[model samples]
Target: MTSAAIIPSTDLDRPELRRPMTDPFGRTIDYLRVSITDRCDFRCVYCMAEDMTFLPRADLLSLEELDRLCSAFIAKGVRKLRLTGGEPLVRRNMMSLVRSLSRHLKSGALDELTLTTNGSQLARFAAELADCGVRRINVSLDTLDPAEFRRITRWGELDRVLAGIDAALAAGLAIKINTVALKGTNEDEIPSLMRWAHGLGMGLTLIEVMPLGEIGEGRIDQYVPLSLIRARLAANYTLTDLPDSTGGPARYVRIEETGGRLGFITPLTHNFCESCNRVRITCTGTIHTCLGHEDASDLRRPLRASADDALLSAAIDRAIGTKPKGHDFIIDRRHNRPSVSRHMSVTGG
Candidate 1:
């Protein structure tokens, strides 16, 4: 693994850079999710089309620029930083970036440094990630059946992903399985998937598929509201609502039978945007204050314009000022097109 050069700069220590980022809704934005790359190893039917056109390497921000931009956010009181991607692990020398950002964890400037991965590469990087002050991670796994997994991911191997999950568990990393509740594909597997995840002492989060992009398949056929899933599960199992949150949009409940926690991300059936406290930055340095909206501010220009962060900070402030009260995400037969033209991979999940 290549080691990123760690440079101590006075830019983040400036008095003007210490203010907290607050949105127009009076919510303190402390969480920042950065997509290190738009490239992934899997072509999940809901996330991407079978044939994808990724961004060129030159279009992506270098590790140094990403570090600087993240540092600016850390200075602005971002307590949690999540490195997301089409698959963050697939990026070359990604550990170097993780290593560089681990300094914030040591200095008490950040509360958490983690990532959401597909788990295909976790077997190789889990140990190093655990060494880098990362205590937990979220792995996207839609189905547990080998054949069903392959069908959903399009090119993934179930055994390999399972191996990666085992590796992460052995490396002392708390794993949360993020399953996109697909309508006809894997809806029947929800109970078994939840049982398997909870049986391993891991948390399971069921996410309602959002209408993000055109993935060759109609999203109306794939969209499954979590309200129905929750209601169905409540009838068969004991689901006690809990006020616990892990800093994202998931609402949690305790499963009495499994003695484990289960989370629901109901973006469609329920609008959890009222308490939105995070923003996403694509690999190209475009910051989207709301995921369901196309409103974004370009940070790459300001970042490359000067070595100073004044320009970057001002750009961020302008974006946050216009953060929408909530996103307008709807999926129906009439609306076959995506709400946001950009793929969920491009905007960072």
Candidate 2:
């Protein structure tokens, strides 16, 4: 497949627009994860460096541009739209984007409009998000301990985040807690965290530390395979594998003890690339076809070149055509570098 940047402006001008986006591997690309900003309030140790350099605000697409780009995707059969960020709520006027995108949900073009947030600003924005038609959201919370939370996030306030979660729950939003299982840090707290989330009627998902970016430390030390977590859980409770997918790379299981659902995202021990039906777009309007690959298509130029989406749509199509069947993610024991150099926050997750 060719790069969309090199494609002529006049290419793909056919009247038959809005084709269902399907990759060469026959996976229907229906989910789009868009990063509104690369700036976060707290610098998580596993996600980014403590003193990190972020993209300038000028490099990020404006709210209007994001709306148009997302609309183009919805026109092409993207049923789900998720807005993400280093911390999406930290962005000024971020709710404007959410409120605008809720139009798709109202029109029935989009099945769901949601967000993956760190829950720092959810206390202030939870009501607005629910008013804008966000029924469910994913909050990334690794540990429930306040001191450990401070150690992990570096700048996050545990009480503030908990208050935000309470506000979201009070707003009637279905919440899913995403925890990254760290070997020595939060591994011991996994069971307690799971029980806390399930006890509150929120689903908890444990994710393996992926080799994605240089977080100024060795991922080998932080990595904890979900297989091991499942094994440990089996010693005390029964875990029944369940066929459940939330349009992402997670396998679900029913814990008979808690009578609640649990999810595991094992990118290193087991990959879900074969069933990947989503792609991510950065704040700078670059479309990454796969999270593990460096190859990307520039949609900003086409998006800014013309108001019409003909060139932008063609670029998206070309990018999807190049989607690899699987990704190569390995955490090197000897190296501090990652297999994929880009940070997970850059790719919106």
Candidate 3:
């Protein structure tokens, strides 16, 4: 298959003509997180339940349809795209799509294109992903202990994840480790994980366990604030704040004596919504305007049935136009619990 994207490079991204997708609070929506599939191999306790039901293959946006939607978003001023899922690699032959987007990145149609995975299958696909113009990969690894890993994910083996990390390094892919810092669980392992990630020359991002989706009664107990984790890490080393070069919400810091960088994605305690720049699209083509709220627009109708880029783009713009400034995700959990909670997997967590 040709590496060139079917979309043209010039008119494909007329940023000036497109009205900047500014939310009601004035945060420009430029990052697009696309869920390729809701199917995953491992069921992480924090992210998904043991027995999960995935969407039917027919219900998902076709790869070509996704490409078209991405084209529309790009024209509308989406600068970055991250491929996420229940496990993006679980989708069959995803490299085709990667190659397709890689061409866009190579041609400057996007500022960056990245992928987030559980790393179970990275050992097999790392080299190809690197060769296809994917410069960076983020692997979700909550614990370094084998038993704890098994307990957290309920199925994945730590050895496989380690092998995937090795393969990622072998392929020369810039890597990041995303660990959910659960309150009583893995916060103590922060130093060890930081050391190991720095040893591998990879930056580690500690994400506070958010109240998103259902935690099955473990929500309160699992919520670990970044303050606690930072305090724990501070005992061992000093951390200096660094710039968030990638436009992500993760507040970065340079780990004082090593080549390591650390970041905290505190969705709860630290409200980064003032600079929030992301919008999520589910595998079935629903545009989630904010991860904290349920405001969404079903783009599949216009995207697939009508094949009208104008309609699809307008639908997305409408969703962003009224985007909530901040999610009451934490507040709602404190008082009246909403009857409906969005599953992190379905929303591409």
Candidate 4:
């Protein structure tokens, strides 16, 4: 582990020399997704192989170091923060970090704070997290069938996950159910998942399976496009577009007379990279300019070595300066791309 250097406060005021880099899309990259830990109890097939390698404890960023990085990012125009991981709740004292971040937010440093979890542990942590100022949660649950859930996740915690979802709603956390639509696996469960989420008064998002890293080898053909998902839903349900919602990656629609809405993310067939406005910070403090691209800027070293805000700001500027215009996953071999990182668990989805 490397120790951070302390510097004088006078250096923080220097004007940043770097300029913000904009992609072809007009959206400014102000959102930061931080992966708190790579450790998770359940092994989902889409995110991990049956036999997967885990990062050593010494390799992950310390909580204090993570706080420093996050504080600096907030100062650099990052208003939205999403804490993610193999499952962020698996990190011990995660609520402590959430509390600290809430303080920063209360002080007007951050505008929004959210998290993405597998929901296996949400029942235990939902209330505590709600008290910590986490406003939203995105839970990954592909199937409503218990047998298929166990088969897909390789774990028998389906009941526990459902309980967690109920707890989150009770705790007043805005919930979004994220389901990855795979052809032979969980495609048949889309309507069921949507109906369940809607009945619970929660939003639902169906994501097209993308070819990510080593786990993506046999999963490419399983991607059931968003168009098909919508068409299937239209057969039995009346689909109405919510025009007030802004268009980005997901196509937002609502079922008539239903209180809940649905979202569709078709990255493979319909690229959303043009409207992408987010970057990610890996568990080890590497700044990823794009999710599809693995090349990243190292900010841990400079952040630890300098207390100067200007220097920190400059480092952020440099990271965003390298943000790519768009990814070429369609023409290029995304799974085989040398730049793609090995594990999504550590990278933060």
Candidate 5:
């Protein structure tokens, strides 16, 4: 029941420790995104294909294995940890993991622990998560219109998501609304969504759609750049630049009258490779150096074979060293990576 003990820099910089993970670009790797499970309840068109296949349970990493991997990353100087999913809460043992991470937070082994979910199952776990130590929660909510909600999710109800949002807010969790702006779909609802987020005192981020694995053919048509969305927002209100503490790529702005903030994640329009300090691990323990290029090292094999942190750190060092200067998809529209073939869900969006 103690406050966040906060991991100290001294422990990570011990003399006997392995060399810190620094890429060729001189970026210090400290952020880790862990995808606990690949199974998601809702089928969002922009994220997963309508007809999708999930990983078998046997292939998924066990809780103990996940704990070992996480500990190894923390030992290597990772400060911020984000638990993502196809929808993390859908996994039965997610809360136990959350509680364990909460212990790590209280013990100064981890700094910040957060989660990103579709919010379909949030109402049931919001209070427990916040009480345990999850301070930040990002919910992917595209539209407020019930009919559009159903259309985008294929079979989701808007009220349920709104209730989940309310539940998270009630639990005193810092909520950020993540909306994917599509040309014909939720583009027009941007302002409305902003007002809604502002009304609830939450920040909103508008993400421009990218052509990720099997997001289905019309990416060229569906793509809506932030430049256009920013213009629409500026026309209605004055925006002042607001830098974020979270080293994420989203460019944040404060609205004029309401004093609310808006975050724009323009992966296509702008790439944040120079400051990219994060690495992702799939549920099965594959370390993906970059989100765009799928070249990954099967970390599970090494973890299962050995428990030595020094050895684990060496394997991770090799993966971090391989990070490309930047993702090519931003420049090359049809860019394809031979190394990565799975969708964002499997990659842990």
Candidate 6:
């Protein structure tokens, strides 16, 4: 949380460390999630409380600053970039950033460009996004039951999200539906949700509810493990394992003879930290090497002070150097998960 700048005296002439940050399992972390804003239009029960506060716009990073930081990161071996937010589309001129990032794709500097959204504004921006070279999207759709959707999100317009999903698909964007699995809330609706997504040619990723800060307290009692979800799916339909696609954290499986795939992200019950090659940059410009750790490196100060390439590179190196071998949440065997001061909206889910 400190704002002081730490400048390194090293020069940029040193040999570039292009080596992939691989784990014991040989899984490399090449993905980076950058949160553009902490503000969201919906108030999901598991992400925020009814009275949560928002960060001031003045504190958030400007588009130019984000582009510079992104360029620095790309120069440092980060190949894939994911734009996230309380809702990334909520940020002004988001398409402009997309367009700027698209320029990198032409040079093969960025391999993949994606975004995660709550889908309230997705319909309005899908075409512009596709035109800007965004190829993939991940929409968080917890339930199809309109009443349940409204109840869970507090103020989400379900129809709007559905329309957005349709728009994105119409625009030729590869889409995925991200659903957080809770024991009593929408667990029973998994099959229905999967069928819906599959019907639309979109993959469905079922995420195990995680204890991410105080908001997690409301979900602790409702956590649903992967084993239970798999069992439930098995009872309803036959599943086939997709061959040669087991590298990522999500276990990809598909219903027999179905077009859509099912993914499971079991962070709470099954720790995937050993294969975590991804890091997160919050909207406030803090770099989080691990999702479950308290450690973070501030990048805003140096970035704002017109630091030279050497200093910027050194800062990135220091942040990655401090990246823990793995998060200690599971190793510590703690039952009560700590409450994260920054909400997921701000942290980019």
Expressed as tens digits, the lDDT of each residue in 71-99 for candidate 4 is 66665567789999988988877676777
What's the lDDT for candidate 1? 0.90
Model 5, 86-144: lDDT tens digits are: 88988976777777767668988678889999888889899989988889889999999
**Residue range 28-69, candidate 3, lDDT tens digits:** 788999999988889888777687767889999878777777
TM-score of each prediction: 0.97, 0.95, 0.91, 0.89, 0.91, 0.89
| Per-candidate total of colliding backbone pairs | 0, 0, 0, 3, 0, 4
For TM-score, the strongest prediction is 1
Model 1 residue 256 CA deviation in Å = 0.2
Model 5, position 39: C-alpha lDDT score: 88
Q: How close is each model in CA RMSD to the real structure?
A: 1.2, 5.5, 2.8, 4.3, 3.9, 5.4
- Pick by lDDT: which candidate is best? 1
C-alpha lDDT score of every prediction, in listed order: 0.90, 0.88, 0.80, 0.76, 0.81, 0.77
lDDT of 5: 0.81
Candidate 4, residue 136: the lDDT equals 85
Query: Model 3 off-target regions past 4 Å?
Result: 1-19, 331-340
Residue 323 displacement (Å), model 4: 0.8
Model 2, TM vs. native: 0.95
Which segments of model 6 are wrong by more than 4 Å?
Answer: 1-28, 243-247, 328-341
Record all residue pairs in model 2 with backbone atoms less than 3 Å apart, i.e. clashing: none
The reply for model 5, stretches above 4 Å from the true place, is 1-19, 330-340
4 or 6: which has the higher lDDT?
6
Candidate 2 segments exceeding 4 Å error: 1-15
Find the number of clashing residue pairs for candidate 3: 0
Give the TM-score (vs. native) of candidate 6. Answer: 0.89
